[model samples]
Target: MRVVKRINALVLTGLALWLIGTSIAGAAEVNVYSARHYPSDQAIYDQFSKDTGIKVNVVEGDVNGLSQRLQREGTASPADLFITVDAANLQRVKAKDLTQPIESATVNEVVPANLRDADNHWTTISLRARVIAYAIAKVKPDEIKAYEDLADAKWKGKVLARTSNHPYNVGLIASLIAANGPEKTEDWAKAVTGNMARKPQGGDVDQLAALAVGEGAVALTNTYYYARLKGSDKAEDRAIADKVGLIFPNQDGRGVHVNVSGVALTKGSPNKANAIKFIDYLLSPTAQEAMATKGTSEFPVRAGVPQPAGLPALSTLKVDPLPLTKLGELQADAVKLADRAGWR
Candidate 1:
């Protein structure tokens, strides 16, 4: 009888220990698939884990790469959250039905209506303006006042840009479509393409470098590239950044075009509850501010947060009232129009 009681006690203790270990293993972990490769983002994740006691598992890669991976994994995808650098990429993920609507009040309150999905599938954490960087020696500040003016004949053989296939360029075209209608935007694209300094071949940073080298007088790119260049430790890079002046085009009309780096919860996330919590944490003021200051040289999507130093204030700029949702919807059409206009 004594031996049997001891055996039973040992069995009960073993079962209790097993349950405890399982609970600890399961405690508050969220898996993230991200296209943003900045060290600052890693810091944000670290802070989030420390504050919430939620462990984060991050898989880093390109936006399209991660999107394809998510599709491949389908319902079995271990991704609890997806993050990427552009609104078009966010739209792509949302279109896959791989992201579910998040009803976090904190998100809704922190992120602006224009920077989030209508169904709340994603929320932009930071904002970057699409501005023109001009070589100060070659171009006068007053010569370029808006995006439309890039098509002016004076700029012919003096414009540098990335490929029209880039999502940033696509989004810019989408914004033009939103502001000026397809007909005018198509005309603008044709005229602008006629003005290309060279075939569109490289990223925004390269475009800026080309401008610095006098290959072109002006380059259309995100503001962050110049900011990064200005902050670069390399002497040549710093010189290139120094020679360029940022122009917030279209301020008199629709203001400058902007895009976002955002996050969403995966549709079939294994840890749905933890994912929601993570999303909430990401949209929190702390996270948004950190991203703006560190990760992308962008403006925080949260209303009251001051934009990072050196960026034009959002309030000062005459932003279009068009919802970003429209931009996402019009992306395919924008690309088609750009292609038709021979925007290489």
Candidate 2:
């Protein structure tokens, strides 16, 4: 009877050891649900893993789809971090209670306060300016100096942009509302809608292409799109880049409206410690430099990183200081204003 009891105890001990081993292995990796599909992102992840010996398992999808998956998984979700572009999407995830505040002194010290969430629920890792793209042959560089300039009578039927509901447009209008009162912004939106070269259609590149072919005088697009075209292997893309000139809008006022590619800690973070370490690693100089010069072509959130060739240094550009958190808060209002203004 004593022998039998000893054997049972040994079996239970082995089972406990196996469970402990499984947990340790799992804790050595982080599960990332990332909406950023850039091929350069994988290279960054690989570098992180090489440096820290912690595996980065990424599940790539669009923001809305990934957000839905998080909701469906609930607390049982294994996602350690959620990485996506646009503060508005981060705000949506926070509103759904899918994210928790990121508690890392390294992250706080590295990223600017305006570029991070007010409540620490998210932080931007890279930035891209929403600038005016114009045809040098059509619009003089000084003609459209600010976003407000687009609504002027002279620009009527000459502005090209994507649909108003796009997150990029939403973030842009939200920044406008933050700068100007809602009433004035709405009026501006209405006038800008009337100024559209055609009904809002296609992505930023398409808008730029339209401007390139003389379909419009100017278009609103993120800066990186132009960089991508300039660096593209295809002759046609480089041709579009050659024909288009960019105006960093509002440099004399609140500065150009810039948006971010940001990240957040999932509320259901299974490997919280490892996740935090990974977040810290992303903000490091090596990672920042990699992101900037890699296929992404975005400015690093960290100061002093080198800009891509032919692009102005980040320090030279006057970026809007409005806390990006406001982008999320005012997103709904921005959407409503766009709808009322016929920016469909």
Candidate 3:
């Protein structure tokens, strides 16, 4: 009887240990493959972990690199979610049929119709306006009022821009195609190329630096690039930020063209439920505000979120109402148009 009771106690202890191990194994965790390498994103993950007790594992890389990696991983990929910088990149992943449609009340409530994928494959969390930045000392504010006006003869040899091959530029051209017909867009591309102050080179930030040093009087760039500069701790960058003024062109007609940094769940995500939760966390009011203030100086996608101080109000600017998905579809055409126009 003593031997039997001892055996029973051992069995019970083993069972208790197994139960505890199972609970630990079942604890929720989500894996994220993201192109946005920002400290604010890490903050969001920390907050989400605190709020939900679910661990977030983030892996960062270039947008195209992450997308290709997802494709290579196929169904066995450990990635629960994917985030990227542009709508075009999001569309590329969607085109691969690697993303599953998400139905989350948080996403629908936070993101506007134009900023998300129609099939619910992805949703934009933040927006960056493509605007004209001018050297404050050289260009008069009233001289440049619209995107079309940039092609005017007087502006020729006075503009600096990134390569038309850049995704941001291509997205802006795509917006032109949506607003005007293809013929008009093609002409505009050719005319703008003629206005180049120098051969298109470098990123948007480089264009702003050029404007500061008088390399060019005006530049086509996104708003956040200057915002980033202004927010930088480096004094030289801040000085450059001081020299340029942002102009939301086409405000009178079709407001400014905006692009987004967005996210989606892989179609074969092993943890679909956890992926949805992660996306919802990103759209939460706390997350939205965090993005505006801490992540990128970008405007939040969520309605009613306060605009970051010193930035133009989203409501006041007339945003082109083109669906973001169309931007991806027109990307190839926009690139071809740039090539044909010799906008290197």
Candidate 4:
């Protein structure tokens, strides 16, 4: 009877230890509400979990909507991080007081000074250039060498762009404002608006498609869209991609404007340390490599890692020196300019 009771006590102690261990592991999880819904991120997230024991819980939604949700939830919100594509989206969140400023030596060391927020509220993870996708048949590479040329009379009714309010277009216009004052950028806006092919319908990929169909001669697009089309399994996608040529406009001047995808910490995160750890992990070489090669096909922000495969070497193109944070700063002005110019 004594031996049996001793065995029973041992089982009870083991059960309690198992329950405590389970509780601790559950507490190690971090919740993220991200607008970055890229499918390639799944493997990266999985790898992070494998490398470190912390689990990631992700809820994907539009940045504006998700930020609003966090605002409503306030301190009660479960979100520890917000990952979004446009710098403008990060600004929106910061404006609403939904994100907290975080400092990490790893982040500052890995990301460029201009790519991360000055206050350390957010940091860019990857980059993509907004460039002119010209039709080889209609225009020679020499014919379209600058973004300013899009407004030239020679290309009137030949321009292809998404709606004036697309984050990509707005960011580009904002960069123009940073490079050339608002007066010049606004003038450029009015001229470019008059050059649109057909009321600016469809996404970047659609514009490339229109270029193939001869609807437009020059389509303004981000490079990755062209890359995907060029690499697509579908013959139709590859065929459209074939007729398209890219011009990294303003190379002799301000260089091509770029947009970035960024990550930030939630204001009242319950897991701030873990969140920072996750962000640090993302900025590490392993994560940067994966994000650059497999995810968006955009240039990685960190040094040493190469830009996406098949994309041009980062060394070859002159990057615009204007800090991307300016895009968010001047976004309101850009929108108003686009509106006044009747660039609907």
Candidate 5:
């Protein structure tokens, strides 16, 4: 009986030690659901782990798919953070109540107030400008100056754009609606649709390609896409970039329209503290430089980080001051207006 009692106590002690060890291992990791598809992001994660002794595990998917997954998982979700592009996408997730407000002073200080959520539910990690990429040889820069100019009768059949359903376009039109009421923005959309060089088709890169080949005189594209082409290793991509010149539209007015890729804390974040630490690390100058200057080619939200080469200075262009949260609020309206305007 004495021998049996001693064995039982030893067994309990071993089991308790194992359980504690397992919990410690699990507590040292953070799970992330990320929609930003940049390949260089892995290195950034690796660095975070090295610096802080916290492991980063990422699940990648499109914005909508991930948001749906979070909703399905509810409070049992393993995701501590959700990262995606575009204000509308972030807002969509927020609207679904999949994210909770991130109350971090470091995040607020590193990222500009305008680039963060008003309620701190989400914040921009990087910025991309939506600008007019014109065929240098075909269109003189002065002739096409503002986003509003695309709707002019003289530029009929000379505009190139992606489908209206694209989030980038939705954000653009939403900003326009914020700047000018829905009615006038709708009118602008209708006239711009009337000026299509061809039925809106392909992604921004394709639009840039079409412009390079003279399919259209001006193409609406993100600055990073142009930078990718300019900095591409392939000679053909370089040639395509060479054929195009960028115009930061509305510089004389509300400034160029800029969009963001952002991060938010999951409503049911299993590892909230670690997730907040990761968010702070991402906003750090070192991480910002890695993301912005590496393959991602995006402008860092933290002011002092250097932008990728060949992209124009962020300070030079006048940025549209409309709160990005408004982009999400007006997104549905923007899409409806585009459809009514025939911007297929």
Candidate 6:
């Protein structure tokens, strides 16, 4: 009876050890909950795995949805990192207390000060500029000199945009607030409303398509969308793309409006080491090269990485000076102002 009891105890001990080992192995692999849905993202993750032998697990979803999920999961969340395209989403995460600050020397070196949170809570990896697009035959290149210029009476009944509530528009409005103050920005928003060719409806691409159909003469769109259309496999898309000329507005003053796809270390990351490694890897030249190449329509945020040919090199455009975090704070005010301005 004594011998049988000893064997049973030994077997139970071995089982517990195996379970602990499995948990540790699982923790070594980073779990990335990302809203970035680009196909090339997988390639970068795969490369990171190949180099470091650390596995990457991804959960792709909308930024708002993922932010809610992280809050619901709380301290028990297995997420090691949260990736998103907009600084506003990162601000949302920060507001939810769902992320922890990264203290990596590598991260500091790779990301520029202007492209990251002041406290290191999140870091931008790539950039996308919202530039003004005009139907080539309808408007001259000098017609729009800046974002503020779009509100001129000449542009009445010619502007196209997404909904006022969209984060993109809100961000732009926020920048306007930072530059020209609430009162002036509101006037600009009102002017934009007066100039709309129709009710503000549709994504950037839709606005571009409307331009092609003569519904509007100018539209606000991201650089990548235009680049994608120019390089699209569809001849129809290419045709519409060719009809519009991209204007890097504010070149003489504030520079173009820029947003980003960035990452934050999730609170209580089970794989902190691997998480930092992955973030650093994203900021590395290797990943930057891949993201800026033919597949992905973004510019690498890291300096010294050669931009892909035909891309608007970051150095060439005048970028707005307001930090992205400020954009988040101004967003609510922008929304309220938009409501008052009758921007639909």
Give the number of the best model, judged by TM-score.
Answer: 3
Q: What would the per-residue lDDT of candidate 4 be over residues 1-344, giving only the tens digit for each residue?
A: 99999999999999999999999866787788989878888788888888888899999998778988999999889999999998888877887888888779898888887887878899998888999999988999999888888889888899989898889999998988888888898888888889888897889999999999899899899998988878778999999989999999988887888889999888999989889988998888888888877777878888888677657966588988777788899999999988988887
**Candidates' TM-scores?**
0.93, 0.93, 0.95, 0.93, 0.94, 0.92
Q: How many clashes in each candidate?
A: 1, 0, 2, 0, 1, 1
The digit string of per-residue lDDT tens for model 3 on 16-61 reads: 9999999888768899999999888899999999999889999999
Model 5: ten consecutive residues of lowest lDDT = 308-317
Worst 10 residues of 1 by lDDT: 304-313
Query: Which ranges of candidate 2 are over 4 A from the true structure?
Result: 1-27
- Quick one: best lDDT, which candidate? 2
- How many steric clashes does model 1 contain? 1
Error of 1 at 328 (Å): 2.2
Ranking by TM-score: 3, 5, 1, 4, 2, 6
Q: lDDT of each model, Cα atoms only?
A: 0.86, 0.92, 0.89, 0.87, 0.90, 0.88
Residue 147's lDDT within candidate 5 is 96
Model 3: ten consecutive residues of lowest lDDT: 307-316
Candidate 6 stretches greater than 4 Å from native: 1-27
The true-versus-predicted C-alpha distance at residue 227 of model 1, in Å, is 1.0
The CA-based lDDT of model 4 is what?
0.87
Model 6 Cα lDDT, one tens digit per residue, 209-245:
8898788999998888888888888999899888988
Residue pairs in collision within model 5: 255-318
Per-residue alpha-carbon lDDT of model 1 for 233-254, expressed as tens digits? 7999889888899998877777
Candidate 5 vs. true structure, TM-score: 0.94
Ranking by lDDT: 2, 5, 3, 6, 4, 1
Q: What pairs collide in candidate 4?
A: none
